[model samples]
Target chain A: MTLPPLLEQSVAFLLPYDFSPTVLLVCAGAALLYHRGWRRTRGGWGQALLFWLGLLGMYVVLQTQFDYYAQHSFFMHRLQHLVLHHVAPFLIAVSAPAAILGAGLPDRIHRHVVAPLRRNRLLGHLYAAIQEPLVAGAIFVGLIYFWLIPSVHFYAMLSVPLYNTMNWGMAIEGLLFWWMIFNLRAPGASDMRHYGYRLLVLFLVMFPQIALGAYIALSNHDLFGIYAACGRILPITPLIDQAIGGLLTWVPAAMMSVVGGLVLVYRWKRQSQQVEQPLSPTLGCAR
Target chain B: MPRFKRYLILCLLPLLLGCSEEPPGGWYGHDITGVMPDLEFNLVDHRGKAVTAEDYRGKIKLMFFGYTSCQHVCPVALSKLAAATRELGDQADQVEILFVAVDPKRDKKVLDEYVTNFTPDLVGLTGTQEQLKAVAKRYRVAFSYEKPRDNGFYIVNHSGAVFAFGPQGKTRLLIDDQSKTANITADLRRLIEQSSI
Candidate 1:
C-alpha cells in the first residue's frame, strides 16, 4: 500500500530526529576533515570560522522550515536559490578550505575522489581549460540561465534527488566562481589583466539575474504552475510575492557581486600603487 | 574625482538603469494574475448539490478554509470577507464566498448556518476527511483536526488566508485575514473590473 506523503516525509526527516540524515552525515564528515586538517596546520580562527559557518549555513538552509515552505511558496524558493548560490559560495570561498579539506579527508576517499581528478589527463586538462577566465565566466552565467527555465525548475521542485543535486551543483559551482573572483593564487597570464578579468566576470554575473528579476516582477501570469495554487503565508498576492522575489534577485543578489568586484578593483589599484617608484635622478635620488 | 572613485561610479552606473513602467491593473490585493491557477474541488455544497470548479465560472470566488466551530481567526476572516463583498455595492452580486470546512464532523452539520449568517451567496462545502484533505492539498492549505474535548467538541486548525479567484476561476490574489474591509473591497473591485465579470 502507498503510504501518505506527509507521513512519509515526517518519517524521513523527523521520526528518528528533527534533522536530516544527509545533513548530519555531511556535517560529521566535514567536521572530521576540518578538525584533522586544523590539527595538522593550526589554521587561524578566521579560516576556521568561515568553513564552519559555510557548513552550518548549508545545514540550516537544508534543514530549516525554509525548505519546507519552499515546496509551497515561490518567494521562499527564490530566496533559497539566492542563499545557496551567492551566500553559501561566498562563505566557502572566504574559508579557502581546499588544503585543509584535502589534508583532512581519509586517504582512501581522497584517493578515489581527489587523486583521480588531479591525475586523469582529460579531466585535468578540462579543469585547466575551464579555469581560464572567459570560459569560467561563460559556464557560470550559462548555468544560471540553464537552471532558471520554468520546466527545469518545475521538475527540480517535484523531484527530491534532482532538487538536491541542483542545490549542490549551484553551491559547488558558485563556490568555484567566487573563488576565482577572490583570486588569491600566484599571478598568471597578464598579471594586472588577470585581476581585470576577475572583475569583469564578477560584474557580468549580475546582469542576467537583474534582467530575470525585472521580467518576473513585470510578469502578469504565474510562470510556475507548481507554486501557483499554493496560497500565501503572509497576506500577500502571488504577483506581489513574485515581484518581491524579483526585487530580491535584482537588488542584493546582484549588488553582492558588484560589491565583490569593487573590492577587487580597490585591491588592484592599491597593489599597483604600492609598487616602488623611482625618483628622477636630476631632482631627487631614487627611493 | 580620484581615478578609484571614477571607476567605482562607472561600476555602479548599470544599477541605475532599471526603471520600467508599472504593470497593468492597479491592484490592492497582491497581484497573482496568471501565476498559478487556483485548483478546482469536487464536493457537496450546502444545498446538497455536487459543485465543481466549473460551477463558479462566471463570478469571483472568495474562498476560505475553516470550520463552523472555529472561534478565532476563522470567524473574523469570514466576517471581513463578507463585509468586503457587501462593500462591493451593486457589484456584490458578482462575488461569491466559498467556505470550505476542514473539520469534517462539526463542519457538516453547522456549515450551512455558519455561512448563511454572512450572505445567501456564500457557499459552504464539506466532505469525508480524506476528501477534504485532497482538496486542501490541492490548495496547499494546512489543516488538522484535534481529538475530541471533554464536551465532545474539538477545533480544526486550518489556513486562514483568503483566496480571490477571478471569474475565469484563476487565482488572482491572496487576501490577508487582517486586511481592512476597504482594501479588500478595492481589490475585489479591481478583480471584477479587470476580469470584466
Candidate 2:
C-alpha cells in the first residue's frame, strides 16, 4: 500500500508523538457531546464553529507531532501553554457551550448523575469557593508561577506524570477562569455579580504576568536548563529560544487580559441595556 | 476560621505539599528516584554484540546520550564522567558509563574508539531507530539532526544529561552540565553504598 508522499507526511504530523489515552478520550468525548447537543439545540452557527475550533485546537497541540516539538523546545512549550491556557480555552469559554452540552446529555444520566451531583452540598460549596473572583484569580496566576519555578519546571519537563499533570492543570484552570469571565448569566444570579470585580481581577493578573514575562525575556542567563538538558529540536541558540519563550509568556498572554476586559465591558453594557428595557417581553424572558 | 477559608486551605494543601524543596535522599545530583522508570533497553554495544539492560544488571549504570562526532559537549561530558569514575578508586568497576549514540549511522565505525578515548568503564551503544526512539522517549529526552551542509557533514543535537541508575535498574539521579565531577563521584559513592546495603 503506497500512499502519496504529502498524505503520508500529513498522517505523520497528525499522529501523536507520545500517545495518551486520556487526551484521546477527553477530546473525542467532548466532540461527540457537542455534535449531539448541537443537533438538539440548533445552536448558532458562529458559536458551534467556535466550540469545534477550540476543541480541535486543544487536541492538535496536545496530541499531534506539535507535542514533540513542545517537549523539546522552550519556545514551543510556551506556545503550547499559551494555546492550552489562553487561546483555545478563551474560544471555548466565549462560545458558551454549557446549555448545549447539557441538552446533549441523555435524560436518565442527567437525572441520576448530573442532577444529584449538582445538588451535592460539598461539591456546590467547593464550586462556589473556587468561583470566588479572588480565589479564581489567585489560582489562575499562581499555577503559572508554580510550574515555572526553575526546579519545578525541570522535574515537570523530565517526568511524564508531572508533565501531564502540568498541562492538564493549565487546561482545566484556564477553562474555569475563562468561564467565570464569559458566563452569560444575569449579574444577580451569578456567583460574582459585579463585572467590576472581574475587570479588576483581569487587570491585576496582567501586571504580574507582564513582569514575569519581562524578567524571563530580559534575563541574560538561561533560567530553564531543562531545554538544554533535553536537546532542543530547533537549532537556535539557547538565549534566542529563552527570549522567544519569554516573549510568548509576556506579550500575547497579557494581551488576552486586555481582550477579556473588553469582553467584560461589552457584557456590562449589554446588562445595563437589558435592565433599562425590562418592559420588553423579549428582554424579560431572555434569562 | 470561616468555613470558606477552611475550604480554600483544603483546596490548596496539595499545591503546598508539591512545593516542598528538598528531595528526600539528598543526593548532589537531582534526585529522580521513583520519578523516572527503571532502565530498560535493547541495543548493540561498541563491539557489535546485541545486549539488553539486563546484561548490565547488578552494576550501577550512568546512561548518557550523544554521538561520537559531537565535538564539544559530548567529549567534555564523557571525560567528566570518566574522571568521576576514576575518583571512585576501587569502586570504579561498579560504575559503567553507557554512551548511547543517537547518530548510529555516522557513529557505527568509530564508536568503540570514541568511548575508549575516555575510559575503559565507558561502553558505546547504538541501536536500530525503533530501539533508540524507545530509550529516548523512556527518559523524556530528545535528539535531532540538523540539515546536512554542502560538505555532507551534519550536526546532531542530543540530551546532555547523565542518568544514573542503581544495581536493580531503578532510576536515581540526573546529572546535568553544571554538576561537577566531585559531586557526581560523591553521588555515585552514595548510590553504590545504598545498593550494597
Candidate 3:
C-alpha cells in the first residue's frame, strides 16, 4: 500500500545507505532480547528508556542515511563517533543491563551455550586482561589516535573494508571501555575493585584528546585531506569543517570523563555507607 | 639469554615479513594494492555505446568523477592527466582515462566535445542517475549539485581523486589534486610495467 508522500520520504531517509546484514542482525537481536527481559523483570522505565535510546541511537547513526553524511563530511563523521563511542555507549552502560540481559536468555541456551562460554578459562583470562584498568584505559585512547593518523585515515576512507573495521573497532572499544567504568557490581565482586583507579583513568584520558583536537582545530593547514579528496556532502569550507570536528572531539568527548567521574563518586559514597551499616537493623531506615 | 633471544626473534618476525624489499624507490602515488575492489562499472560512453569495465580490460584505467561544466577543477585535472599520458610518448596508448560525469543533465550534450579538448586517450562517460549513484558509491566518492540561478547556471561538487587500476582491473593507486604530473606519469609507468610482467 502507498503511504503519504511525507511519510514515504521520512522512511526513505531512515533507510541504510550501505546496508550491512551484520549491523541489522546485531541490533535486532539486542532489541529483541532487551524487550523480552524488560517485560519479564518489569524493569524500571527510566533504565529501559536509556537502554532503548542508546540502542536506537547507535542503529540510526550506523545504518541510516546519516551514515552517508558521516562518510562524506568531516564534522558529521565526528558527530557519529561522538554518539557511537561516547553518548550511546555511556547511556547503555550506565543503565546497568547485564543482569537483565542474563535473565533474557532462555534457560536451555543459558545452560548449554552462554554458561559454557562464560566459564571458559581462556575467555575469562582474555576478558580479565583487557578489562585491567590501565590496559582498558590505554586502548580507549589509543584507538582514537590510531584511526586518526592521516595516512591511516586516508586508506580507511578509501577502502570499504578498512572503513568498516575502523568504525566497528571504535564501537566495540567504546562499549568495552564504558562497561568497565560503569559496571554496577560491588568492588569486591567486580573485576576492577578500585573506584579511585577508575576515576584516575577517566581523568588521565582527557588531556591527549584535548591536545589532539586543539592541534587539528588550530592548524592552518588541512590535516585530513581525505575529506577533500572525496567530496564533502555539505558546502562548508574545509577549515570550518575541521574546526567544528575538532571542537566536537575536544569538548563533549572530554566532558564525558567528568560525568563518568561523578557517577563513580556517587557509587563510591553509597558503597561506603552500605559497608558501614552492614549489620544494622535500621539499614532500611536510611531510605 | 635464550629466552631473551626468543622474545627478540618473535618481535622481529612481523617486521621481517612486512618489510619485503621494494624497488629502489616505490611509486610516487599512494600504493593501495588490495585495499579497494577491482575497478568495475556499467555506463554509456561518449559514442552512445553501452560499456562495462571489461571493455577496457587490457589498458591501465584511470577513473574519476566530475561534470563537463565544472569550470576550474575538471579542466585542470583533465589537462594534468592529459599531460601525464602524453609524457608516455608511444606507450600512451597503454592508458585510458575514464571521466565519469556525475551531472548528466548538462553534461550529456557537451561531454564528447569537452573530453576531446583534453586528450584522445580520455573517454567521457555518463549514465542514468541510478547508474551514476552506483558507480559513485562503489568508489566511495560523492557528488552534489547546487541550486540553479535564475539564468540556469549551477555548480556541481564532486570527488577530485583519480583512481588508477592495473591492466587486470586490480586496484593500484589514488591520485589527488596535489599530485604532480611527473608523479602520476611515474606511477602509471610502474603500473604498466608491473602488469606487463
Top lDDT hit:
2
DockQ of 2: 0.64
- Measured over the true interface residues after superposition, the C-alpha RMSD of each candidate is 7.4, 0.8, 0.8
**What fraction of the real A-B contacts shows up in model 3?**
0.79
Q: Provide the TM-score of chain B versus the true chain B for each model in turn.
A: 0.82, 0.86, 0.86
Q: What is the TM-score (0 to 1) of candidate 3?
A: 0.91
Model 2, which residues run further than 4 Å from truth?
Answer: A184-193, A279-287, B1-25
Q: Candidate 2 chain B, which ten residues in sequence have the lowest lDDT sum?
A: B18-27
Per-prediction DockQ, in order?
Answer: 0.06, 0.64, 0.66
Which lDDT values do the candidates have, in the order given? 0.72, 0.89, 0.87
By TM-score rank, best first, the candidates go: 2, 3, 1
Chain A of model 1 scored by TM-score: 0.79
Better of 1 and 3 by TM-score: 3
Model 3: per-residue Cα lDDT over B1-197, one tens digit each = 99999999999998887676442258777778898889788899987889999999999999988998888998889889989999999899999999999999988888888877777788999999999999889888899998898999988989888989988898898888888898888888888889989
Displacement of residue B71 (Cα, Å) in model 1 is 17
lDDT of 3 by residue, A1-287 (tens): 99999999999989999999999999998888888888897778988898899899999999999999999988899999899998899988888887677778789999999889988999988887898777889999899889889999899988898889988988888998888888733325632367888999999999999998888778788889988888987989899999999999899999999999998888787767777786754211111
Q: Which candidate order results from sorting by lDDT in descending order?
A: 2, 3, 1
If you assessed candidate 3 against the hidden native complex, which CAPRI class would it receive?
medium
| Estimated TM-score for each candidate | 0.56, 0.92, 0.91
Clashes of 2: 0
